[model samples]
Target: MIKRILLALASGALFAVGLVVSGMTQPAKVMGFLNVAGIVDPARFGPWDPSLVFVMGGALLLMLLAFALTPPSRQHPERKPWLADKFELPTRRDIDSRLLLGAALFGIGWGLVGYCPGPALASLLTGGLDAGVFVLAMLVGMALARRWIGRVAA
Candidate 1:
């Protein structure tokens, strides 16, 4: 348990540091990444920042490697994580309102503030006042969404 906890904390800290170093904690960096139109126009939103694209590509590459390396066996069908005894992945494949709403909310929030949960959390920890506000609002939004979704699902 102690090992798992320490591992988790170390992994999270590494992720946070990566975000900071990659400039993900900066709203302008994200906004510049999102400025696809600025790529063609150049005068409107400045040169499109392609650093985030590289970061995302690297992450995707890692994900593909992980998936390729550790795919669960169909014959066994009882895959378990190394640290945990049982690992149950989300089985839902059907696209429902929850999925749609969640995606929409995430995109909108990211566009509006340029701070996704990871970056927001990182920035908040690094003493960014704007990120602090964003994190607080994000927490409130999450709680309200949880209550609403629970009621709806029930």
Candidate 2:
């Protein structure tokens, strides 16, 4: 249990560092990336930031490498890396009303705040009031969702 806790903490710290280094913790950078129409530019194709693309590309490359290294069917526990044992490939889900609603909500939040969950948490380190408020609101939203979903299911 202690080992798991330590590992979780270390992983979170590493993730936060990566967000900061990648400039994902900055709302302006994220907003710039989202300006696909380049309305904020005089060149008409300007104001488009490619930093998010490169960051995502690097992440995808790492994921591909990990997937290649750990085939799903490999049963040689002794030879497999820890990730092979710890993580499973996610199964696909069909588009449903819930999924659509969730996606819409996420997109709306991202566009409005320019900070997803991970980057929002990372931004807390900078002691920014906006980040703090966003994080607090997010937690409340999550809790409300949990309760509402539970009631509906029950």
Candidate 3:
């Protein structure tokens, strides 16, 4: 258990460092990336930021490598390394109204705040009020979602 906890902490620290290094912790950089109109008209909307694309590409590459590295499961022989085991994998019924609603809400929040959960937590290290607020709000939102979702599922 302690080893798992330490590994999780290390993983989180690495992720936070990556977010900061990749410039994902900055709202302006993220907003710039989300500026689709800026792609066509840099003068009007400002230059389109491709920072996120590179960051995502790097992440995808790493994920592929991780998937390649993980050994195949014995019980669920057909399952891909990247995917959950047969018992853990969600069914089509799991993709319900709540899932769609949550995804839409997450996208809207990301667009408006320019900080997803990972970057928001990483930005906390900068000691910025905005980042602090965002992180707090994110935690609160997560707690609320857990409560609500648990109740709904029950």
Candidate 1 per-residue C-alpha lDDT over 89-139 given as tens digits, one digit per residue, 9 for 90 to 100: 788789987789899999998998899999999997788789999999999
Quality of model 3 by C-alpha lDDT: 0.85
Clashing residue pairs for model 3: none
The TM-score values for the models, in the order shown, are: 0.84, 0.81, 0.79
**lDDT agreement of model 2 with the native:** 0.85
lDDT of 3 by residue, 46-108 (tens): 999987899999999998888677766777565353333433555566576887898999999
Choose the strongest candidate by TM-score.
Answer: 1
The better candidate by TM-score, 1 or 2, is 1
Point out where model 3 deviates above 4 Å: 72-94, 143-154
lDDT of 2 by residue, 8-44 (tens): 8998998899999999999989988887878556387
Candidate 1: misplaced stretches above 4 Å? 63-81, 85-87
Worst 10 residues of 2 by lDDT: 77-86
Give the higher-TM-score candidate: 1 or 3. Answer: 1
RMSD of each: 3.0, 3.3, 3.5
